[model samples]
Target: MKHVVFLSAISLLCTLLVSADTVTNPPHVVQFTIDPATTHQQIDNFSASDGWSMQFIGKWPQHKQEQMADWLFSTENNTKGQPKGIGLSLWRFNIGAGSSEQGDASQIGSVWTRSECFLSADGTYDWTKQAGQRHFMQLAKKRGVDQFLGFILSAPVHWTQNGLATNTGRGATFNLKAQHYHDFARFMADVVEGIERTEGIRFNYISPFNEPDGHWNWVGPKQEGTAATNAEIARTVRLTGQEFARRNIDTRILVTESFDYNCMYRTHPYVRADRGYQIQSFFTRDSSLTYIGDVPNVPRLMAAHSYWTNTPLTDLKKIRQEMGEVLRAHRVRFWQTEVCIMNNDTEIGGGGGFDRSMKTALYVARIMHHDLVYANASAWQWWRSVATGDYKDGLILATPDETLVDGQFTDSKLMWTIGNFSRFIRPGAMRIHVTGRNNDPESATNQEGLMVSAYRNTDNSIVVVVINYSTDEQKIRMNLHRPRITFQPYLTDDVKGNDLKPIRTVQSGSVTSIPPRSVITFVAAQ
Candidate 1:
């Protein structure tokens, strides 16, 4: 009886072991591959702007400010040999128009949204007023940010028809007075020159308008903004370019930051007539509107915001495909200049909630992949680098109080997920072709819920970013085009916290397991 009972107990133990293995570690049937020889468009750079959020955050304690700077622009590794921050290649500086000084009279209700202009309403130029913004700019340069752009949402309050920083009570009409066009151009040019002289950082690009297609009429205390006809934009670009040349400024003019992708190619009935059909309106050689493509100091690229239209996977793919087709035919590149989780129709509902979870991170990753792969955007930029509100808009969030505590700021997974691309895929990296089965299909929506993109740096280093949106772990049988290449993986998941933790090196044809709901970047030498 003792022998029989011992034998039965051993059998039960074996069964329990098998059950545990089945529950915890399931088999992976997904296989993916990459072909380096197959190539795609070249990637320019990735960046985020220090907009309204930076105004106050820059005045925080020195240590807190430095920490935020290092996280965004530090290319060097930490003492533990991990990448310190995303190492952004470009930095955007918001060129305010004296709205903040107006206080409640600025018509912009939120003090955070109101920005101070170097040229005050009294026509006195104060170079020192925007000290906080300048400090961040200097920090970016110190940390090796290669590109700088200055963007304006509204002209000075004195120059507008309503004499207010917020829009005139008109829909889709140019809020900026037609008489002040040349003055505005001069103001912008002077700003470009002053920054270079004072801060030792030259503005490489100046975006004169932001979302000009949207109605900016004082719709219940929104940010300072204006709408302009494409003709007016072309006029501004011509004048701005002429002024830059006259002043010997090397900064190029970036035109027409369209509100959405569809706005670039099609006309919305509610939108201003001159604001829509942007690609053709500005770039086409034969259009009646003055062609700004050949204008001095104007780049051949067009920029648009990646908002609102990032949902219903099918629409995302179709609009991007159409936009890509138009751009390719015209030989003009696209830059997805700005994005944040705004519309509530996303996979994760968008809100002002300061969520630091992977859910928001994964949603952003999917949008980034779509922009790069489908739209063929040379550069991808986030809306705000830091935020003080409980909004999903910021990559990093801080407390609303003017003072900074020890742990007042929080870094979201969105920042690290973006880092997976920006930190590794440095500037001048060419996006190479990556074809595979299981999860690597080129569809807007994949059954496996995996999105993958590959890039090759100028030095021929390979970087592959894989996003697993599903709940099940995917076993990818990676078949590289080259032989004997070893890859190290850096993961941004709940377990690893966006650190580039290296697992065992795997050679070509080795099976790699991608954790569920994670973003993984694999780097390999040529």
Candidate 2:
């Protein structure tokens, strides 16, 4: 089904008449006025990682590879000046540790999860390795991606205590040997320098550890992961900072990617005290542990993953509120650097099953709203941008083939749903306050039921994104502070492909209908 935009008055009248007849449930009247005076966080970027999937897909035929690149990174517009893809401002590059070349001995059974490393066991460097990841980096740069991030899941196998990319056991401990901290730091610095010199893409930020509080000691070939205590992470950062300074590298260090939002503020009884309450442990000046916030090149930002905390709407709101309060007190910013559907607790069941429907996409959008609105996150990013499993993880899915050539691929509504934000809300955009009421018949519903957020771009353009999770059409009455403004609505729904389709033009203080179970972005230039 093609999306019909009621551009003309006749078409609008006919669609309204049909909708009135078909929609028995009374339309929700949402009234919201943007308040630029009450501005919140400055949005840095909306990004995704080119991890396990990119290592292979980057090797795909030129045409297919170019298509994926354009879809993820293109900032170009049609002749009418509408965006083609979600203009992502940041690109995350995975810094591999040579597990892929080691085969089954690497412990990561899936070749896709294993990654190529530039450093060999003999302390030799091969800049030519990880050509696939480099290819994607170049593509992202060519498509106007300004920020590049290099995140690591594990250190080079040779430098690890267990001699494997993964942890030796399920214990929450650092896998990299203490004696080899300097070696690992130097390795990271060298890689950053080599890529910048050779490929002309300088990593603006480098995250050394991921999910440091999680247990990665599971057996078999699932994924390459490791755990580290907060103290260990601080030590690594301090060392890495020294290495970067010694080598005159300018990339900033990103700290402690927590496994969950709670870990950022609360210490789990099951985990070590030093491994949890990361924001306080790492950022606070008087903390018992070594504080790395004062370290050079360490930005005043705390990164955490938004997993398992997105449920029971109230709980989601409460967690983000608590996080925002704590971060604001410390004068530190928050970045939701990683998220995927890893649980089945809410209305949307999550599992390894691949879900290409709007259900998963809406679930993700709701979380994004909570993170941005409640948590005041500066940047939000998804996990793997591409996937090769039966999991509802990737924005784009590809065949399970290890070889990249001639493989089938598909894009999900989740990709376009993210585009509802990333396409318009570029970097430096400030989130403005928007308050509305979704008076559905169900009295138990909250703001999550019909989430709406607004942002002001650098060019003074306003982008309002609305996510309607209900079954009835929503009539939103946007009361802008500035009058006589025209809004162009771009919708992502079941009928339309993942690309954003421009719908009818709307005026300030006028009514616009958002189809049930759809995400719509209304753009108005100032």
Candidate 3:
């Protein structure tokens, strides 16, 4: 209630100083109009990555693991009206590259960052590998989670040029060798088929690379990642698509997971680097060296993370606006596949420290709004599902560091903040055109205050998420002309332990008081 109390004191102090003739300014009323006729991208899903953390937490005691999984995957709600979990529609399964098998020899610092491979050096496949990850996948399915995307961060270490999953230094080069591209592609297809046949979980989409842009140097000992030029990425994707076709794998291939948004539309950082201008490089008909859009089953889609877009908020708007324009011109669908707090050291202290306040939630929620409304992103996914550290990475914060054994796991405002969009907006839901009278949220000049976005689900229901970042509670009017009874509001903010908790329902066409520093998802189902 920092915002509420501070504003209250200011009002009181102003009252004492003002004369009797002092009249109060009217509340800033926001007019929202939803146009169903002009609809945008069909929201594919809201998802989080399992990374390497799940391998440890999935093996925890059944109840503990269930609790964690329930928070991430459960679609049901308690009798008290609190959602059991955020009900993420898609779960990103990380395809390991044998980093964990290398151990100390791998040169990757964090044991938690290492991942086990299903394919060994002898060219033999082990379906039993990544047991912990499989356990959570089963739990997610058991909890009614349907969609899954298998994402590979890096090629297997044995196939890499350096015989390591990642480089120790920065370089504008593909980690995997040219001759091994086909083998790596086959390996990816094999993993997709292997998981379905043995683990009983069929991957809906398979991503060949994670942040394969040249701008990002994946020499980090902190985690596992690789950088590849656009041409190499295209060649690998083509090979992977061919393998999928040959094996009759039903999963679609997702390619060129750019590290950041700049790389997607234009060349950034290195002018000579071919990683930039990914949409043109990979999807357009002009560039044959990197064009894979025509490949069988490869969708006309581009995926990029929302990293470094936090600072100067204007950059956030500009980058997305430009990206949206390019994406529209190319007619390519976009998905914000991965993002966590980064590059904002002075404002939010970067992603170093733990949750000191609800800043992380509010910040991320704004970016999510822009991604869906501005960039026309069909899918949005976080970097990690469960964070084992003090940083603002994971949705659920686990205790005892590694989360290896049974430990305490706490819900984060970031998780519920994403839920404000994810929980209500289901797959196949189309984002209807929304116009605000006082301000256009997509406008760069309008940064603060109530940032809003609305989506119409497949069942003809509407979900509107309102985010109030200002210190004062803002009043917003919904001009939805649909026949609705009451709109339910689930709030997540600095309200002391509020995790998508339901508040009093409101009548139709009411001006709602959105609390400051809070994210409220108003669901009005027909």
After TM-score superposition, what is the CA distance of residue 386 in candidate 3 from its true location, in Å? Answer: 0.9
The total number of steric clashes, by the backbone 3 Å criterion, in model 3 comes to 0
Query: Order of candidates by lDDT, top first?
Result: 2, 1, 3
- Over the stretch 292-360, how does candidate 1's per-residue lDDT look in tens digits? 887889988999998877788787778888999988888788899998888554578766687788888
What TM-score would every model get versus the actual structure?
0.91, 0.91, 0.91
Once fitted onto the true fold, the runs of candidate 3 whose alpha carbons sit more than 4 angstroms away are 1-26, 214-222, 270-272, 401-403, 438-445, 479-484
**Per-residue lDDT for 1-526 in model 2, tens only?**
0122222232122101101112246764534444444467899999999878887788888788888888788878787656767878899999998888889988777777889899988898898888888888888898899899999998998878777887755466777877899998999899899888889989999999988787443331267778887788888899899888887888999977788788888876556676877888888889757689878789989899898788877878899989899898887888999988885544776657777888888888888988998899999999989878888789988884544545888888898889999989999988865543342212222454566677878876778787888777877665554346678888888875535888789876677787888889888776
TM-score, structure 2 vs. true? 0.91
Superposition TM-score, candidate 3 onto the true structure: 0.91
Off by over 4 Å in 2: 1-24, 28-30, 79-82, 217-221, 400-402, 437-448, 481-483
Clashing residue pairs in candidate 3 (N, C-alpha, C atoms within 3 angstroms): none
Clashes of each: 2, 1, 0
Q: How well does candidate 1 score on lDDT at residue 170?
A: 60
As a whole number from 0 to 100, the lDDT of residue 410 in candidate 1 is 79
